[model samples]
Target chain A: MVKTQIRFGILGCAKVGRKMCRALELAPNTTLYAIGSRSIETASRFSSENFLPSSVKLYGSYEAVLDDPEVDAVYMPLPASLHLKWAVLAAEKKKHVLLEKPGASNVSELEKILDACESNGVQFMDATMFMHHPRTLKMEEFLDGERFGRLQYVFSSFSYKASPEFLESDIRMKPDLTAQGAVGDLGWYCIRAILWANNYQLPKTVVANRNPSLNKSGVILSCGSSFYWEDGRVANFYCSYLTDITMDITALGSNGSIRLHDFVVPFQENEAQYFQACNSKFINLSTGCEPARSGELVRADLPQEALMVQEFANLVANKADGLKVGKKWADICRKTQVIVDAVYNSIVRGFEPVEIMS
Target chain B: MVKTQIRFGILGCAKVGRKMCRALELAPNTTLYAIGSRSIETASRFSSENFLPSSVKLYGSYEAVLDDPEVDAVYMPLPASLHLKWAVLAAEKKKHVLLEKPGASNVSELEKILDACESNGVQFMDATMFMHHPRTLKMEEFLDGERFGRLQYVFSSFSYKASPEFLESDIRMKPDLTAQGAVGDLGWYCIRAILWANNYQLPKTVVANRNPSLNKSGVILSCGSSFYWEDGRVANFYCSYLTDITMDITALGSNGSIRLHDFVVPFQENEAQYFQACNSKFINLSTGCEPARSGELVRADLPQEALMVQEFANLVANKADGLKVGKKWADICRKTQVIVDAVYNSIVRGFEPVEIMS
Candidate 1:
């Protein structure tokens, strides 16, 4: 029996799509089967610039990619507004959906898309590449250990200074194209991180910080939110399109603390460093080694994004029980969307705390 | 024609006093003149343990040390409850006061102590040694530079896991001794860090996190607060006596970000590291570092506490200009107290936002 390769079709020519195309090529179990754009010239240009294999097919419309019987999966990197339409159609076409995140306009819309994926029995996963990194799994193991004790507080930040040109013309800054703005762009990862730390426990309430900057279109350029759990566990996150690039996650537990400077994306493609300390305290002589520093360096055999594609493809190619939807991932995506909505609601209500309804 | 050395007296045999005694010895313009404990036996034991100079005097009572004409300055490491009484008496007795933090129960009590110090013309300084570190001056220079641009957000945390014995019997856990508890101990450093980042601009509002762990005596063990400025600048601090040692200060400015893992006390006594990024942003290829990375390692010529002793001694020894008080330090101490009070008030009022009066 020959090994089966999941053929993935590319949707749109977004900057992120360029990275996804390379990821598909790098993923051993996935092949770049097709490319789709509004115009064939644009599709051709993307394929050329990305150096796509000549065997890859090109189409002028996303519908053509979904229609191709050879394509087992469609990777959608469209704008947030377009995700609801394209993702549902891809799922309806019985193709696996590897959708870029801010999965939908909101939780309700994401629920609808998830419904389609569930009904169609197609594997669904978000393109949150960092989640697939070995480092993330290692950190989770540490967090689950007794040495770290009970986790109490978490802080995550993801921000980057968008160029003036991007701020002026990028689809992310257009209210109609991406209604959630930076909330959906950067906050998605931050919320996902908080939930991941808590074993995907949703917070009871969320309050946005009061210092969000908005573009002329009333799109968020920068924002933050604080989340509170029933057990007095707290998490806050900051995201921006107007600061130096930063991705941090700091978790404080009863007996230890874990810190990572680069969480959304590792500083390097293959390795990442995180700091953890257990039973830390200052000893005699006013010097502290109780938080004896442990710099954990996690190395990945493949780049995280490639690993993400490979993982998604593995689910799609799992013929033991035929292809089935990754229901937990869809649930996780919906929970993340709910939090994004809660933060947006709080910001809309002038920074008032909003209860998150499960 | 003789360069008059400021004679120092240490009150109480608290663990911190051990460090202060060494600082006084290291300071070029200061000499350990006396040590006062309730019993001469205890004072003599402390002197012997600390390897003090043979010329140092021992006093059985704090009042006797204050009464000694040669004791030009008194380093008060007594409990918070005694600060109001002994600090005022030390000032009234013409001895400069180097008081440990949480100088008093509240701002009102600290105000009285400050008033006495000002009226008596005796120098005053808190033993927040990090403030006197040469690295602090360097950080300030970076904050002042155009490259760092405008400061917008600050996060500070200071925490350490206290031994079980300390939790049960330390003066810090006793309401009658240090009423503010963790808010007075670790939180003092956190608040000072925020103020230092903002150039001492007090926030308009303070809101404590809902989940503060309180001891049986109603003294705080762990707490956090968020402070908001009118111009949308925000700061937050987390402090605990129930977690591993962690001291971090991260300041995000318009053009850059500055972060130090060891802010309250340097990881090493002689040198410390801080990371800063100016004009940072993400570029093409999905990898970051546009702001680039700069790791600044600062070396201290003398320990921070020794510098604090020397600075305080300089003011006290300026007899040619009629020995004057370090008035600015007194004001800083007062402002820190006001913020601490605001956090405590907010926590007490069900986590409601409290306005900082000053």
Candidate 2:
């Protein structure tokens, strides 16, 4: 019997690529098949500095990784502006695409990438690691349970104080490299968290908050926006590169409420916790109340990134088992990009409400 | 030496009045001097049910409590529509006034009450209990410290599920009884929390969210709004009667973040906790982070309500020490009411942004 573990290749030597390299090594059904950079020396140096296994392949150019017959999937962590080109090439080569988020520069670019993957019969997923966390599933259960009732509101914030060096030299500060700045870097996670809490329902309209601060290059350094659904469900998100690192999600429903202070990245690698309260009420003298909250600790056998890798590999192997490629994730990725573009449009139009056509 | 305890007259038998009655009893410088209702039997029954001392006075009309010479201060917990009438009468009688929140139907009515208090030369303070909590002081210390830096963002949500009976018949559900409905009841806290977080600086504009759900009489049952400062500081709040009870305040500054789950009425009467994070950063493999958070417990010698009564009494007694009547609290209350009115106006104008004119 032949072993058929999914083969993974990562593009670029971005800071995030180091984490994905470790995730591919830890994921049970995946292998670290290749690492690619524009320069062979850079890729080799990254491999050696990280002490990666000797059997892993190294390529000088991204196209070499896509052309490698043994690499079953490409984990594209390239900049947001570069996604459309590399992702389409990877898909045309029959490689499943695991892309980083803000998956594309805009909806049109994201649509082109998605269409290429669909045409080539490959699974496509954004590298949103927290989505694969066991705690997220527990939160979803609470949101979907009878005790929780229907969801009404969601609020999320993600921010970190970027170093002076990062502000000066990071690709994220370059408009041609990362179009949305903090909106792409930190706000993507916040927007994804909000959409996930609402079961990926695209909001009818998006309104940018009036207090966006832009950098010298006119890139967003900090910003916020609100999402409105026709059914009265609403969500808001804030992201910044000018504040201390904070990631939070609060979802309120008719009967229950859930909150996590570190939803994007858990405080601990192996465990995550969320607080929930149900049927809360004020009692005796209004000093105390019923439905005292309790935090549920979810233990992860593998870290969230590893689980994300494992989940993507499972989808790839499922296709090998004669199943149809999963379009649900691609559809979510497209919708998220559409909202991101809508928020940008709204901000550019003096914070006017932008109707989400989709 | 002559004893100088401030005397408190509670001018209603409402459920909240019971809590205030206990607070007055517990406050070191205050005594429960009088109880009043439309019927003498009702006042007497309330005193007996609440186990009031036998020496306490009972009155058949609110004006009777105001007329009592021994009642140095009046705690008016009347319905919103009745606040302007009774509070003015109490102020005309030269009694220091401690009034319940949503102190009047709108900003104009609140301004009238403030004017009356100013003309009478008596202290005025709203009975916003949480403001007096020791936890609030501790949180303020953190916010003011170098570690917290300058305020950048604030988010607050206060909600509670209204029972069917309460929705159908409670004063909070009636337009004449509570003109602002959930906005007056729950949103007052949220708006107050945001204003307090910002050092009571009024926002330049207030924009109500588009999805406010209103009762049949056109009172807001659930709503949200955003406040924008001139220097890019932003605050938003969500208040509701249709969601599970959740009181949350998350204030993020340039250097640190502070979060408290039970900001309004804490889960415990004597102790409250807030979490603060400073200089947070991701460490090792981006899996875990540095500067992990720790909760600070603020233990109170007196319950928040009792502290509120104590603080108000101190201001009243200060008048005897040749101090002018404390106008700080009244000013804060007026600003909060102005923002509340602005939110209501924005909603009334089809969710347009209303410029807040001080």
Candidate 3:
């Protein structure tokens, strides 16, 4: 018999995990089964603060949560450095893995986790919630349709100003914990958006900008890159921990263009919108364009994170019903990781062009 | 005696010159004094088609317009390669020069034109009309105020898909006429927007993207570049003649961000708008941002082009009153040309970093 609801065990008390806990509650096919922290007191505190059901289990260690027979999946929101070990262990324990973004320090480490998931016959997905938003689907339709011809250029930016305390104590500022720094934390989304715009085709080359803002520990706080394809297609992205909040993507095609100011997180929870212009041309006398860009609004039945949880759980349920593991999410995660690795490598090589191996 | 109205002469019957002809008529302190082309028949045809006043003069050669004592300023919409010859001649004849962009083939040629203007006591300005739009002034206020902290990053894109006939015949595709091609035609606006956001401070280095689409004549059809400054400020821009019409600029600062889609040409001629978010932060639970971007609309008393003509006329009128030639427009044009040269140089050197000399 197939399980109707997937039981999710969250393995960290990170601030992002609080949002995921709420997502788990909202997803129809997912339940918050367990909360785990290094100390039982922390787990209990998180459970009480989030108002988890009394039936929810509390554990002092991630290993205990992974060992629980009733937990069908694990949501790991740990630091980037810990992803490979815990994500691999969760997959080895036959639990579906919904790991947080910046999936691993590098693609090599991420591959190890993917290998374990394949051997364990479990689902593996990175929690890029924005990908699950209905607005993304609407934009994809425009990109793939005839109105928007071949994609030629894409530009994305993701940034937020960090407070003084965040700069001093956030895990992202530490070289050992989030080694990729702003590139891993904020750039992951920008890179993913670029890859998505290009139908997951990796760029021919990547070159990071030279003037990266680095902390005293040499961690990148801000950086950008230009991506090039063999077909003369180009993409660029800027990510920073030192600028005001901005999430934008502008994708242009031979005949159309699409722009969205809030690609990562919509301003509102229930609805999101994007602007598109097809065959826009200047009017007579070049006073203005003939057809102004039109905004398309998409309504979401559930929050983006909740929809992500539902999607992950549906895959896990199908796997439990004797179906083969779906590879789509894994493939998408790998592509995003490869670009992230290439960007980091380019930065390391003094802003030299780094060809994508794939 | 100081002239109360600046009489404008236009060189070349190029398509853009038609727009400026209309602008001269609309500007309060300017008049369409003369229309010049390679042939008198062509100039007469343009004058009749554009419905010029019966009092306007027609000239068979650009030099004829410069020699006309009644013409106080000349708007030269000649090809990029011809600017060096015609702009210098116009200035030598004591005609204030409002040259269409890209001002010249390179800074070396532009400097010669500027030198002639300064020695002749005549004003020099590029016809980048958007710079004079009231909306730009409003956006500048936001960028210069305390609401937006130090500018850290700027990204701009300007592209338009050209028809097959255009690719085959347009001067922008001919290296002899517009050697810079898309870089000069479209990228000029993007580079100008970047420099405008940064207060005309030239970036320290510019590196072109590796994949630049080139025409058969070796003219750039599409290209992009990443700019780096010593203070960790960065800017990137993409320009193309092979994509849909898109004009965008997103400038991010430490405390605020501003975005506008129609930066080059407003959607409507009468009014323009931009979006800004100051001190925006994610609300509790990270569900959504607390302050959404607010759109600021600016109404134009005259079209941007007309305002540009009026501003140029005012400068010339002041010069006629024995005031020194204003150096601000000249300085702006020189800085923009410097970056344009650097971007082309970087592309020529196989996507290598090219440093700005001044």
lDDT of 1: 0.86
What TM-score would every model get versus the actual structure?
Answer: 0.96, 0.98, 0.99
Top-TM-score structure, candidate number: 3
Candidate 1 has a TM-score of 0.96
Q: Taking the tens digit of each residue's C-alpha lDDT, what string does model 3 give over A1-358?
A: 7888999999999989889988999999999999999999999999889888889999999999999999999999999999999999998889999999898999999999999999988899999999999999989999999899999999999998888899999888899998988888899999999999999999989988889999999999999888988888899999998888999999999989999999999988999989999998888877888578888899999999999999999899888888876599999999998998889989999998899877
Q: Clashes in model 1: which pairs?
A: A280-A290, B280-B291
- Please tell me which model should have the higher lDDT, number 1 or number 2: 2
Cα-based lDDT at residue A290, candidate 1: 51
Give lDDT tens digits, candidate 3, residues B1-358.
Answer: 7787899889999888888888888888999899889999999899889888889899998889988998889998888999999999998899889999997999999999999999988899999989999999999999999889999999999988888998999888889988878878899999999999999999999998888999888999999888988888999999998888999999999999999999999998888989999988887688888687888889999999999999998888788888876599999999998989889999999988898876
Which pairs of residues collide in model 2? none
lDDT of 2 by residue, B111-204 (tens): 9999999998888999898999999999998898889998999999998888889888888888888887777778899999999999999999
Cα deviation of B271, candidate 3, in Å: 1.0
Off by over 4 Å in 3: none
Candidate 1 lDDT tens digits, B111-144: 9999998888888888888999988999999998
DockQ of 3: 0.84
Chain B TM-score of model 2, please? 0.98
- Put down candidate 1 lDDT per residue, A121-159, tens digits, no spaces: 888898888899999999999899898888888878887
**Total clashes for model 2:** 0
